[model samples]
Target: MKRYIKSTIGLCLLSLLFISHKSVNDNTVIKLNSDEFNVLMGHQGSLEGSIKYGPNKGNGFSEKDNDIVYGFTDVNDKITWTVEVPETADYLVAIQYTGKEFQGQTPDCTVEIISNGKVLSTALRGLTQYNESRKVAGTRQWFDEVIPLKKGINTITFHFSEISSKQIKAAKEELDNGIPPKSSASIAVKDIALVRPKVWNAMKVRAKELKPDLSWMRDGKYGLFIHWSLFTYPLYGDKQAFETFEWGVNTFDVDVFADLVAETGASWVTFTTCHGMQMFPAPIKTLEKVLPGRTTERDLIADLAEALNKRDIKLLLYYNMSPRGELAAKLGIEENPDKWFQYLNDFAREVSLRYGKSIAGWGYIDSSFSAYVMNMPWEKYYRSLKAGNPDAVVAISSHWWAQYSPFNDLQTSDSGGSLNNPLDKKLFEEGGRYEGLQEHSSFVLDGSWFPKEPFNGIIRRDSNSKGGPTFSEQEYLDYFHKMAKANVPVTVNMLITQDVTRDQPFVNPKSLEFMKKVKIALGK
Candidate 1:
């Protein structure tokens, strides 16, 4: 049976209700109901909504009669309540609310907690109400924070900020364009309680324990990451101008590329499907409908997956979640964040289903840290990927190691620089459910991912001026050995060159030679 903790009324009222009850201590729980609290609406010339009360049956709330307070959509709305404290000390504040979503789309609600007019904490909460019919249920989640209280009556105020009109307009425009409407944010407050620190710690520990296992990632020691796009081509003028899709996609050769990957002796290769300025290669129908003539005619992902499978090399696809530069502006992502996010999810679903088991994993970049990208329903996207291919491992680029572990299969660090020290495996093990480390290392002798000039059809050993400086064989072996010792896998980035006339794409000859020497040094 689940344990339930009740609240304490007051010292004077306690004697009349329960004379035989024990004295309240630091670990005591104090719960406040919505109907009994003071409500302040329209703080700064904002419109006011309504207060709703219902049977608190869902989201772990067992209270009855007027337990929920909701319908405040203005950004300046506030809910204030007073609680009588027995002593001055630290307490854990846990708010229980019901979040509703539509078809797996949800909105964000940010609540700022103020005690005696001083701000204590601000939490951005997600409310998704996708029902059980979708094989995923949107239920209640708890947000807990540590707060200090003084003896006597302490007034705590909760400030609510709803989604802006601009965001809602964007979602409506996307709906008109035949895209499913993302979820909107609404909250039904069941109860607000203050508990001991031990209770809060227990809840955190339970969340960590429920994370998915990622042992397969740890077993794969070294992998190759290819970041090729329009930027791979030579730029004559400003060097910062965006290259056209026609020039970059027309020269890619999957067969020659797969053969070189087989010779590297690496277990896996991650291909950048879409970057900031270009979509490398895709045949998804959704993308074709949304943005015409932007993708490659050849389905490089499918051909590469098939070729790598024969050589026992796994294929991991990389997609940048937060895109910038000219390509993003052309797609009108800046005008409507929700519209672009809907398109992104649709594209992810299409590709994940089309490739299925042939694709071993996915690496999502630039979302975990960006506030705009975090506002979207990324959990639904992750779920969509898993729905298509359950065996595939998913990871996100997050500086906080375990921040995405609850939703993703692994975590990635794009903090790439000179390879010198070993990664702290212990740091990655702390907050996440996964059990591996992923670090990026670049091989351009100049320490850049792309070369300044194009290699003119010849495979030269000393093309440092054309491409970047290639890593020495010893440098590759030493870095691999260091990663292996710490059980951390490294995805080394290598530059690529293309022959437009012959329709050929190949790795830089110097880098390829370095990889072969490293393979021999590893005795593979």
Candidate 2:
């Protein structure tokens, strides 16, 4: 959201140098673009319309150089704010924006309030941006609306479009002829003020509520997790890991995967979405933008969701985060925690929005990426993960080894304990109720998550079977019995030894047989 809009016209600038004509009332404004507690849902910082100082527009650099927010072209591109108000009341949102419209693009926007599930939006009759070179000269009032805000925290989202493909095409042609790309779409927000709301019969919205019910997760004590990724297949000569990874994704058969999980009688399955090398099985635009070839052409995630849902099984995603690599650096995310959070949040938004309804949960695959766990914006990241599907639960298993966090729905431990393992210390010791976040833990069924290929034939030769897959028959059942008694959700990771055995990623026949019995033992 814009804090102030100053006229940059040469004549207006010289004559009004002393007199101030600030655009809007700053006191009643809510900082929509502020990095404090806002998330640019589906937008990237690299594509911002940085045309504030064009040829003959400005002579020198100033503190207010990049003072405008731009590019609301993509349908998903939107700015969201979690605002805190004193009480429930009617408020007027006064939007100020300058946009160039062509090829059917107009001064149009969709204002969404997820809190109340309402949309109060409008479109200007004429073109909002009349001045091409002068940005502030194009500043005009967007339609006003008295929106009713709830008390406490309210999430307001703005999805808008000011520039069209025609303008972008023209700008591209201009770029070839010694001109810059200035016909970029933008969001020039002004202010929000308190107002008396008239009786509003606002149209209902499809935004889901954040009240997630994980009764299925709690009841279905056993969850099957598989680390099936590009690593599943060996790399051949001159083959990049990603290229082979795409083959793995394309070769994956969702029906076979569903049958494998069904054989175990597991109600939920945690499949790796991004792992060791950060390869995604679906065409996530955000991932593609950061690094080409990291995403697959097939929508494997969606297919998996369909197959699992058909069998009454929940699809949970495992996000192995390491957002400090070359891929992330290209996304303007370096060592900075905020930068890391921004990229991750954008990624989560796209994934969540796409598969929110079909998917049930997300797990930050245990302290697996500890080296790059920059002080993440947990709250904002959580919010973005629920952007499309509010009812989906999350498990912050990794990162800080955080057992329980208010930001997520499940508290997890990758390091399983002994007979009395997978414990929620807060509930057991502090006598605290695990209200929103439930106690959850994961351990491998046998060997390790990845085969000894990366281990270079070096494996843990010890007899330590606490969390490893060396448990005796009794130990396995006993573990589940204890977990069921304590009412904690536990995930058992299975090692995929071969790909496309019987047209499916082959799991150990014994583990599948054992899990079927385990399900019967639990009497679920």
Candidate 3:
């Protein structure tokens, strides 16, 4: 029968009993006795234990914790326990075998243990992989070890270093952050079995099995960013005028955009497949009737995807976590959170299934707005994309979870003064250093949001643009070069407008030329 239980104490304790009675061909005997199971301090709930074959197996073993705990593994396995002695002396310890279920190993854990809170001597302090997986119960059976203890009056430090699912995640995250993975925090203590040691072994091993080395991101530093929107049309006035929220009024020229990317010599190019208020390929009959904003008639996404693919440049699609479409309202899922997750999941799945290997990653916009979209169980969505394209990366905007949440493969920043200022620079630098080791596969830089000429109040327009030097090629080069010095990969916007003849508000012949030169200067 399928059983669901929480807590590692149950799993480890139960494994002790089942493994002992299985009568295996190997002569290895796992001894779990009570003399070691009486260290538990509980007030209310009853503790239950169980050990299953694995995530795939259905049948396993079970146990319970009342006043004492029980555990068993290969004879060579070692468990460490830390206790704070009031004074320090020898104390008589014995097992109270009164329960209906009892299974124990030879030579109880009372081998003349002495302690000074400084030194601990155990015949063996860690378990081997063969004994752990074949005899032990849990996810990461390969990485479990006994912990060293430093005793004190108020604190008894117990180590639980083991291979388990949770521990494996910690190791990966720590590796990404460039820190040593420790097992003390991942394990739980039951009665006598210093369950702290080897608790995380299961987690450590699992992480290694799923992910591959991420040394590729450490080198590629520059990529071209193509902001494909309805606003890529020809305009008058300032050549960069189309570089505003007004991109809706513009029509993108796909052929020109593709030619520009190829000419620019960018190793990778990212395009906005969907954005707020507009999409390419003319107004959809459904959106035209329902959505109130301007719509386009061109399938800009399809055009650019094919164009970029032909050039062998890596492609990444940008998706808004918070959609501007009627789909959010139609599902009546706004504010409900859980429903919104389902909607986003479906949308992302469809996007990945269609684009698949052609795309390298999805740029998540407005991801900082909510935790559900930013932090919660979004790994499933990431895995969905990976399933479609095994090598695809998942990039989120602006240090979304760098501080106190799960880290993404990519870090983003908006060069807009608010987030791109010196303060942001300091933050990213520190975060970059911290994450450089663990997430050696990640990148951090500007290009998190729409780079426009101060439209919709999101961007602050320059006060001196009226009298100062008009937007020039040199300024463009300077902009990109500044980003390169920060050790961050830069992705700037190239918006498509409605009119085919007008220059984009922020981009013109001069700026594109400058972008080319800047790429060369950076040797990208």
Candidate No. with top lDDT: 2
List runs of model 1 lying over 4 Å from the truth.
1-216, 234-251, 278-280, 325-336, 371-374, 400-405, 432-446, 456-472, 500-505
Q: What is the full ranking by lDDT, best candidate first?
A: 2, 1, 3
Worst 10 residues of 1 by lDDT: 37-46
Over the stretch 383-416, how does candidate 2's per-residue lDDT look in tens digits?
A: 8888888888887652112222235567654442
- Model 2, global lDDT: 0.53
* Candidate 3 residue runs with Cα over 4 Å from true position: 1-220, 230-251, 277-299, 323-327, 373-375, 398-407, 417-487, 494-496, 500-506
**Model 1: lDDT of residue 359:** 90
How many residue pairs clash in each candidate at the backbone level?
5, 1, 66
Q: Write the per-residue lDDT of candidate 3 for residues 1-524, one digit (tens) a residue.
A: 32212224343443342222222332221222112211212111122222111111111111111211222221222232323333322222211111111111212121111122322222211211111111221111111223232323212211221233433343334334432111111121222222232322342343334443333433455565545443332333234422442353334555665667766666567666445433423343434444444345454455566777787666777655543245456545434545656655655665566667776766434433343222234445556546666656666553322221123455553333221311233223332212321221122122223334423311212322222113455655565555545555555544333344324433444445655776687676
Candidate 1 local distance difference test against the native: 0.50
Q: Rank the candidates by TM-score, best first.
A: 1, 2, 3
lDDT score for residue 106 of model 3: 16
Report, for every candidate in turn, its global Cα lDDT versus the true structure.
Answer: 0.50, 0.53, 0.37
TM-score of candidate 2 against the unseen true structure: 0.54
| TM-scores vs. true structure, each candidate | 0.57, 0.54, 0.46
The number of the candidate with the highest TM-score is 1
